[model samples]
Target: MACQREDELQELVDEARKIAYEGKVANYIPALQKQNPEVLSCAITYPNGKCVSAGDINQSFSLQSISKIITLAIVLMDYGVDHVFHKVGMEPTGDPFNSIVKLETSSQAKPLNPMINAGALAVTSMIKGKNAEEKVEYILKFVRKLCNDPDITYCNDVAISEFTTSFLNRSLCYYMKGGGVIHGNVEEIMEVYTKHCAISMNSLHLANVGAVFAMNGVNPVTGERVMPKEVARICKTFMVTCGMYNASGEFAIKIGIPAKSGVSGGIMCSVPGRFGIGIFGPPLNDIGNSHTGMKLLELLQEKYDLSMF
Candidate 1:
């Protein structure tokens, strides 16, 4: 059965690549504009320690907004949900991923959810680091644990370019600081967040992340607990609720799985007891998700009935 699934998955990967032309690479970020919009790939790892991949699985890309998932989950584990929620609320804004108007309108000045820029800033502030460098190290350590790849490091070019061009992000950070939702040297925190956002990994490495969620934070291959079950649960909840930016609702209904999409055209999905999936399709759609990635997920779930909902 696994072999049969792989055969079909490979075909789907090929089909997904063809649809890349239907989308466009993220143009707002000057650094990301160089990505080959034709790239598309999928890597899947099942709980039983099997792996399957199709397309350009070796292509590297930054984690982008997807890193928010790691940061939020890590903070929740360290600070507990009560403390974390005090700083960032758990509701979606249904606005652009970087919208600042919502921050001003929010009653308590809390970022609507950890998945958005304001919320991610609040969450990053709660990461238990005494300074910017320590905070980045903590996040990098967690990312390495998830991928089990010590050689991993963020893309410096991407981080630097994002920092230079990110006028709106700086504005959002300062706004959050004023609202009292985020406290710290706003510059340091924003730098830390951008660096984490630049952590580079390929599709297969991302699949391992999904596989951990598949086992409820346990390394299925090693039996080591990678994350607490409760923390895993919260991460999955947010992935379903707000992982795909403004289009999250449609993705949830169509794909019926918990997943997160980054502006870099990467997605990580956890299939509970089945398998973990990571997809890279650099062309983005109207709502900032990888366009071909979204289509591929819909088809895979249809083929295998992988939806949890």
Candidate 2:
């Protein structure tokens, strides 16, 4: 059965790679603007410990917003879900990812959920650390544990480039702080959050990370409990509700799986008790998700009966 799945995955990858160059790479940030639009990769890790990959699966890329899922998980582990919810709500806002209007106009200015930029920045601020460096180190430790790869490190070039031009994120942080949503220094939290987004990993490593959630917070490869079952369940709910920015509803309708996407052309989709799928293609659709990556997952879900619905 594993061999048969691998054969099918190869066919999907071939089809996905051909369309990878059809979209344009994200140009919102100088760091992401330089990525190769043609790079496409996919990897799937099954519950039985079998792994299948094709194309540029080994190529390293920044985690971008995908880091939000891992960071939110860590915040839940550190502060518990109830405590974290006091600062950020679980409801999805259909508005833009960085919209401050909702935060300002709402009775409570807290972010709608941890998957969005505002909520993730607030979550990053709540992470228990003395300073920016310690906070970043803590995030890296949690990410490494989930990926089961100690070598995972933040990409300095990407971090510096993003920091230099992250005016929107900076504005969001200040607004959150003023609204009492963020309790600490705005710069400190932004540094930690942006740094986490800059962490780099290949498709294979990301698939392992996704598998941790699919396996209910256990690292299937390392047999380590990276997060509690309840936390993983909540995170999965958030992923389904708000993971793909505003297109999450459409994705749920089409793919029927828990997944998250990053601006750096990475998508992490999980099929509980079955497999974790990772796709990378720098080109993005209008909503800041990878066009080809979304198409590939939709195809795989239809072909393999991997939908969670």
The clash numbers for all candidates, in the given order, read 0, 0
Q: Clashing pairs in model 1?
A: none
Cα lDDT for residue 306, model 2?
A: 70
TM-score per candidate, chains pooled? 0.96, 0.96
**On residues 57-112, what C-alpha lDDT tens digit does candidate 2 reach at each position?**
88899999899998888888888978999999889878988787778776667888
List per-candidate RMSD values in Å: 1.4, 1.4
Candidate 2 structure, TM-score to reference = 0.96
lDDT per residue as tens, model 1, 1-309: 222466677788878788888898997778899999888889888787678888888999999998998998898888898999988888876899899888788776788899998888788778777888888888888888888789888999999888888888888888878777787787888789889999999998999898898779987566689889989889999999999898888888888788999999999998877778889999999899998998888778777787787
Question: Clash pairs of candidate 2?
Answer: none
Q: Compute the lDDT for candidate 2.
A: 0.84
Best by lDDT: 1
**Candidate 1: segments with Cα more than 4 A from true spot:** 1-5
